[model samples]
Target: MSYSLQKKLVIVSFLFVPVALLLLFLLYPSLRLLQFSLTNWNGISKSFNYVGLDNYVSAFQNPDIWKALSNNFLYFGIHALFIPLEVMVAVLLNNKLRTSNFFRSIVFLPYILNGVAVAYLFSYMYNPINGPINALLETLGLESWIQNWLSDKGIVNYSLIVVSLWRFSGLHVILFLAGLQSIPNDLYEAATIDGAGSWKKFIHITMPGISRVMEIVLFLNVRGALQVFDIPFLMTQGGPGLASTTFTVYTIQTAFKYNNYGLASSLAIILMLMIIIFSYFQGKLFKGKGE
Candidate 1:
């Protein structure tokens, strides 16, 4: 009945649902996953024996797991290589070029589009027969350049990487654009008066100003690379002999298809640790450079 009591009740009411949901969905499932990682449960058996760190050891010793992890690294490396270009494009967009607004929408449109739809769309585009890509290559009289985009082991991973880039590059660009805009224009003016060229201004002023955004973008890249699933799963099914299979995809197959939930849980744990470790080192490395 009192004002303070009412306020306290209101605060508790607001916090109660979210905190309860977090505990139920996120925290409980995570604890179960950790428990599962230490067992030999085949997922169907209610009677699961705790096998200690055996599953963890098996994940490391498995060559297929290593191969899938390599695919993840490929995605990470390719995306990392493109961050500078994405940043440059963001800078260009920030300059308010002619048709920049139109281009901004166009660049970001792919990211908002449905991921499953994009994968299926690209699947048709990359079809060896009657595919637009091959059609265009044939039109250009470059038949030799046209090959199985999603089938060839050598090219399948790259094809999936292309899809990942298409889906996420705009997000990175938008983030950078926001970061760039936050930078004071007066700094640019001062640099201009000091006779600083475009490249020098980018290096000295722009880089420092948007360093925080850069860190965020890099962390996202690492997470995205590691967790990339739908594109590869829907497109190639991590197929053409596990060529395009990523760590996430492998983890899923291990649990559902192979019915080895214990091993899968271990792999999942390793993945979480990897993301945390990589993000930590990346932060430290960037922080060192920042200093």
Candidate 2:
């Protein structure tokens, strides 16, 4: 074979397995889910009727689903608020302090833990009667601050958000730290020599350097907030009369508990589209600001 043909063969050989796996695992399942969304199929039924956009319309009109979606937004908003704080924490830890490595490990430990385990652990901590959180409030003589973390309708969602923050804040910090470390030290040294203050250096040097990682982290926050399931599901079961029901939890319950697989599939598709839309706009916003 000619050299060009041999090169082509090698490229194809390397690409083939990954392409095949992507089609089999990701693309195929997504297409199947899309098809199911247009049907009136109960999950176990061998037969289903095509329902067109009815399922989607129904999903849009459902008040409960919308409430769940609002809860998702709460998750997104609260987490987004913390992104800057996480980055600052990452910056502080990235400094050449004596205990930086130990602190980084401590911060990252929660992210490495199993999600289900974390949810269960928090569930116990939030238990109304014997929970450590409440007990601590009592010990501090701040008994009025203690409330049913997982049961009260008004405060249940906030309680769940706290658990989410504890579980994922470490991850955000670590990502920011990685991004911060990748930046060349010469830039900071040069800035200092030119008499740039710490705030100026951070604004011009650190923020621009870590913008890509920040974009990714923001997209992750959006996706994660929308898809939150374990904490609310395992802890409250989206309880307190659906006060803490997130979009993903509602979707699952719609399918299994209500046996409305078609609607569930539609809800899932809506969620996927929402993530895509948010990501697209976010990318555009970042690109515009960068320019």
**TM-scores for all candidates?**
0.95, 0.95
Per-residue lDDT tens digits for candidate 2, residues 1-291, read 999999999999999999999999999999999999999999998999999999999999999999999999999999999999999999999999999999999999988899899999998999889999999999999999999888899999999999899999998999999999999999999999999999999999999988988998999999999999998999899998899999999999999999999999999999999999999999887894422
Cα lDDT tens digits for candidate 1, 13-128: 99999999999999999999999999999999879999999999999999999999999999999999999999989989998689999999999999999999999999999999
lDDT of 2 at 2: 100
Provide the lDDT at 174 for model 1. Answer: 97
Clashing pairs in 2: none
Clashes of each: 0, 0
Error of 2 at 287 (Å): 1.6
